[model samples]
Target chain A: MLYHPLVIFFIEQGVPVQTVLLLLMLPVVATLVAFFRQVVGIKAFGIYTPSLITFALLAFDPNGLKYGITIFVSVILVGMVTRFILNRFRLLYLPRVAITLSIVSLTILLILVTGGMYQRTGLASVSIFPLLIMITLAEKFVATQIEKGSRAAFILAAETLVISIVGYFLVSWQTLTVLILEYPWIILFTFVINFSLGKWTGLRITEYFRFRKIARHL
Target chain B: MFEFFKKSQGFLGMNSRNLEYIRPNNRKRGMEIADSKLLCKRILKKNNLGVSTLIAKIKNYEELDQFDFSTLPDSFALKPNRGFGGEGIIVVYARKKLARNTTDENKNNVWIKANGSTITAEDLKSHIRNIIDGSFSLSSVPDIAFFEERLKLLKLFKPYSYKGIPDIRIIIFNRVPVMAMLRLPTRASDGKANLQQGAIGVGIDLATGTTTTAILGKGHLIEYIPGTRLALSGIKIPYWKNILRMSIDAQSVSHLGFLGADIAIDRDRGPVILELNARPGLSIQLANSSGLKERLKRISGLKIKTTERGMRVGMNLFGGEIEEEIEEISGKRVIGSVEKIKLIGKDGREIEVEAKIDTGADSTSIDIELAKQLGFGDALKTFEEKVGGRDVLTELSKEEREKLFSSIPDLADTVPIKSSHGYSYRPIVLTTLIIDSIPIPAKVSCIDRSHLSYPVIIGRKHLRKFLIDINK
Candidate 1:
């Protein structure tokens, strides 16, 4: 079997609820958007790879919460190290994203391989391949650092992750899941929403900083 | 109906909708922000939270066309100060055609757009039409539209955003940030986060203060640039928690029951509160995807001391381990759509037998039958809803409503469905109707809910018009 029998068995059980899929996939999509549309200065990898990897592992061990935490922690640790490495090597941003993705992919691969050996499951090991996305991210981060400098690039990456995590939880939510599941196309409203925002030439709530003093002065 | 075909949306093993549940700890102290923008500004200024700058406020409709739309700055937003949503706001970038006020000899007096479109006289007239229709104010109480300066954009997001800067939507219950999402302006969004338009909603993780997910325009999930894959999960937001604190502070300042604080990031200025929304949007719920009703119910009785203290409590309460668990528990998430209800007279509320769900009625009205069933009907004589009934003859407050109601004689509080001849005023009774599951109860002006299309009109008289979902 591609995966351990148990992993396959879980799939057979139809274990992942619609809500679970919702939570798992949201961050990936959000991250993708922040990069392309908003041009948030984050990584730009092919969208499918990372998204698929994340979702496939969604039906992993029942201790999903713990596992998710562990993965996040690992990714962060890897991300920092990847940052230091790319910086030290002076890798360009796109290459840095690629290298970061490579390093992350390698680590995930090693872990999965060793894990497969321990569990006698081939597919389980390959399941972690989405690490390539991090590799892609590394490339983007490196490029951003080169172009926008470390601080701004880092800010972009940080916000991207923050938005993604938020997206993860939101998309993962049950009520949200059910609602969107029913009206998934409501996403189309995004077009109309963008139209509304297009007309919003007013000061942002955050603009109070520069404007507040002006407000006080006025 | 379309939702049924959503099954194939399962592309590459990911969830189609990003639905993050809000945890209990993240919820802040509850503050009932008043609906009045002028009132809210007074409170916000005293509390030091940011709100829109007001140039002047006109009270009636007579002075509408006479007011100088020209004396304003080259760039200013004409807004219905009390308007909720994005309605009734006229932002004049530059002047259009040569009016009588301009130099008569200067042959070409055409105002141009960033895109080079000429602003003709008819354009401004159409805008005025929206204003005259009371499109901006909360209620059609003829309001004055005022002008405010435009916010400058932050350098970091220049490329990503269109002409308009972006805003962050933070939902603070009490004083804590339960959930937050960044609303980015695109060519499609027209530079506004009003999801009713087409702006991108990027979910933010409270724990990390970074962007977690990105949604193009609305619900469709895309990864990378429309053509690229940019991992969107880690863009960090500056002064993250401070924004939550500001929204919460604004609540206390405004006394709004519930609020959606719109904050924006400016390069030199940092974070500012753009507008305080008493009734925010429902997309926040869809964006965050967790029901806020139950969470709001839990903290309904929280004893908050001050806005700052409440903010701190909200941070600690919602920031810790509980968030993840809440994400696991209810998966209730959404960014905005707020309403503040006063649950008084609910000291000993009774369980509702059969309630009607009507989006048509902005507010919820109880039937005299239900009010009596809940043990409060006799106390309702001079109340509002009861007076609408034909036989009740309750005193009327507004000459307009009275005139309107009198003319429609069929407009009884409780007209029987399929009743001909309009004699179907079941009975008008006054009592407090309890909110289905919420702690707040209205000393509801009621009527015989029986025989009406939906029992109670749940009229705007009752509901302050918070966008809602019965199932949620």
Candidate 2:
């Protein structure tokens, strides 16, 4: 069995095999997010947020999934708590979000300090990319909190985290990475899946539950 | 999957709404105009449509710096040029009266929001600064900030709306208004007319302007205005025909194939176009208890040349079903002013006649000649032979009247009707009336109405099980 020439050439060159595999995994992960949104009706902060968070988590801690989830959760917790305290003051939206992001950054710093004290090397040496990605979630969180109440904002944040964790597990699968490296042409199927998802005119799974009272009214 | 698909056959979801209706029908130019409030107002104003008067617009910080706040009207609405979902809009109810001996400079220009929260000139400037920076824009791009004169609440909607102006959302497709809902502001929604913001969406009957059902917040079916005993349904909207016509005009002028026009009825100006939405929410289905998929498909791809024809098509296709809707909600069948009623005559023979429905009368009355034609000639003969005349019965004592009434066969009861001449006694007979295919056993009085247009009149006595839609 022969691999595609592009993959062979990239491996022959100085590019790392893991980098090529992760790059090819982007479409698969994005397609899975699209399926969850279009068919399953799980709207989790849109496609880009969850997919980026998944890759960032994989880059942060490749083997230990629990550590990445903890860091991401603490960022959201800090954002929500700060907004609760700031609700009393009638400040403008941009500055209030800026304060929330500041608090989130300080909390991340505390998490790293705690990690170093406990000799958890993975958390102590977390990369800036994943940490920044986690902190960027605070802006979206605060915006949703202002538009929709806190309960809805919490639900959306939890949904985004759940989808990211699911995407993290899929991308980190050993067998999938090996298969992608062997058969590079398999990546093209993601486009076909997305085409069908784009053309899908069916009711989302959530809408069936939303319109349960009037489902058969027609 | 197939079962779920079949169950949601008439529903229009977000994906299908975008893919089927918005993407294909809404052109880029039309969507662009819909996105920008400034452009939409200009175009709608040029078309001679009713819209809120614009006070001022701030394009950049330089313009914002030079604009004076005190010269504005006492009540106004501040909005972002390219916002969506009713975000980035601030509605001020009135200006705060200045104290006699105030020392502060910035406190002189304070205004109150719909929720009664006071916002000073400095605070408004900062909010407008954020708007100019595109904090609430759809794409987060730079936007313009503007202010427009606030519309006064109509007297009819004073009880239904909380702290904001209630508006009508009319969904239009192919120049035809498909479905419409009256959005009432609630305390939870902070006085905005957006449904997702906890406002009430009441479905309006197209043919007639009466409300049918109401949904609160997201999809909870509600019977009355929250925290009040005022019933949500059955309130008639004034100027309904003009509102529908303006929606169709807004659609054609904007060149959007599928759109939703947000129109508010000002106490002074009548129906004015508030905003035009390229992508409208689907929660209107829950409000109407019907799906958009079926309605959109019913009128898709038909050649509607004029706005009047489009409106007629919509009302004809989606109208007159409010009877079934009202029946589902209030458990009462709605009837028209003139209905075909089948009378069960002698030996089970049925005679159908067009009866005039009069809620003013206390009892159902049948013409004397029509009753004799229905094989009641023997009862009439026995009544005339036993009693001298209706005037004679009127002159009889109570005991004599009871004695004469007991002698007539199939006599349910007797009713005294007072006319301009004098009081008269009519013979009541027990019979079954079939109206709109619903069999109603009733006691109808036989009256001498040989000169009247209708042979029978179904009064309020038999209208307990039905509602009267006079226009129908």
Candidate 3:
């Protein structure tokens, strides 16, 4: 494919092609998360969590990893604060998680506004703002982080982001995307995924926690 | 108001904005109407979809009496218009003469002959009363009943179905026949092919319009119609494309996005619509074992040219291709092959050997020796075996035959089990977890179940509904 002189200039300046690929791998990553964790019984925070977090990171500040790390740290702080509050009150798991997600999402909104006051560079990274996606995701992360505990939830969130980067790239791959766009016959991959999962009979990874009684039987 | 949730996507993916994203967003789910027979009929009629002719609507007991019973066609089927699941349907095959000297008191009652037997007028009245009580309708809402011309049985299903008229059901989504199955009424189905009441449903090959493997009840596979060699396969549904197109057109007329249209073929009149189903039964999945979600997803946004175009595309895509794909996918044969099943009993004894399939039935059973092998010796001690022949028990020496039968107390040499749908039959059982390969405990019975096409009937409580597509 031919690129204009401006595009060549950007490449010469070492624009991150890998990051662009990573940015596109969202849905595939979510699907893979569901396949291995939901169908093949691998435990994770949730199938879509990490991928959404990554998309929000890229969509929010565009320094994909930097944005992802900032949001993750803010989400964790919200989770810790929520855990402390709930532990003091002894709130049930679901309720504590709910409280945590609310605070984290609010924190993200506040940071976005404050960035404008702080620096042009940080603010510039936020163009084509998907403020809406950020707010919703920030809430979910905070909640999961609180309810499932920081380790499990953050790990899931991190895994989701990484796999999403992979997914983002795969979807952007010229051959695959072209087939999907022009032929649309290629969405058969989704069919392939669905059909294979149709006969899944083993315990879900969540069930490992749900039915740990397997240990008792053994 | 919902826009706030839609636009507020802080971090939860767009899929989780509202509960609707996770669950299917149902915009036009037809309310669970009282399943009104009159309303459904009117809607179908208004939409130009052909349905059974409306004979007469009988409201209260007075109106029921007002309708001259003798004036009805000899073969007309009396039905509660609001009847759900074909319940409250009375098919009068023929009129039998009353005793010449019978009093006027018995004259008003409706008692007709059934097969070789005679059910009293009182029997007919109770069933009608049950129909009035909304025994068949989804609700207890009082309903007006009507009678209509009975569908002449299609020659295609004549062998596979036991005395009942069979109907083809097509599920139309967005003016396309997404999936379909043929419901065959059997003796067990009592002339009504309502699956819940024990009908045989065979998934149809969409492309060729031929019948494929059948699901007896939920999951039992049957090839030969009960007691007949009529190949269930290769029987093409008449007016196949016309039926699909008519059903799709009905979707446009009804304005219901999702619906199951049951259209039966009348030998004289061609295809006639049975009834419109808002929420069709899910057994279609078991019959087809193919998912609907994926098919729906594929055609969601794509442009379709016309009804014919969609039908042609659907036929070209989905018809007739499943058996090969399923066999390849599941690594199993699709045909219901005949095999001789062995019956074993207590102490590993060989009882009777019979051919049986794991019907989507709940219990395992055995013939005499088969039951004995299942360790029913202790149970046999209690039953006084009542043999069918008048002298078999008495002439064998009352004590001797009773001793022979009493060894299996639970053994009813003959049992009169009345099915849920108001049908009765006598079958003999010999006791056996129904030690099959599946470790299912069951009461084994012996009868001329062999006389029936399916030697076994497995009920739901036995199959556990836990998704097992056993030997095909």
What DockQ results do all the predictions give, each relative to the true complex?
0.02, 0.46, 0.01
Give the clash count for model 1.
145
Which of the two candidates, 1 or 2, achieves a greater DockQ against the reference? 2
Q: What is candidate 1's TM-score against the reference?
A: 0.39
- Stretches off by above 4 angstroms in model 2 are A1-9, A81-106, A138-153, B1-5, B101-108, B325-335, B338-468
How far in Å is the alpha carbon of B389 misplaced in model 3?
91
lDDT of 2 by residue, A94-135 (tens): 789899999999988898898888887777676788888888
Q: Which ranges in model 3 have alpha carbons more than 4 Å from their true place? A: A1-218, B1-34, B97-126, B226-228, B303-305, B322-472
**By DockQ, highest first, what's the ranking?**
2, 1, 3
Give one digit per residue, the lDDT tens place, for model 3 in B140-164. 4666677677778777667777777
Q: Is 2 or 3 the stronger prediction by TM-score?
A: 2
For all predicted structures, in order, the TM-scores are: 0.39, 0.79, 0.43
- Chain B TM-score, candidates in order: 0.53, 0.73, 0.58
Per-residue lDDT value at B428 in model 3: 48
CA lDDT of every candidate: 0.50, 0.86, 0.58
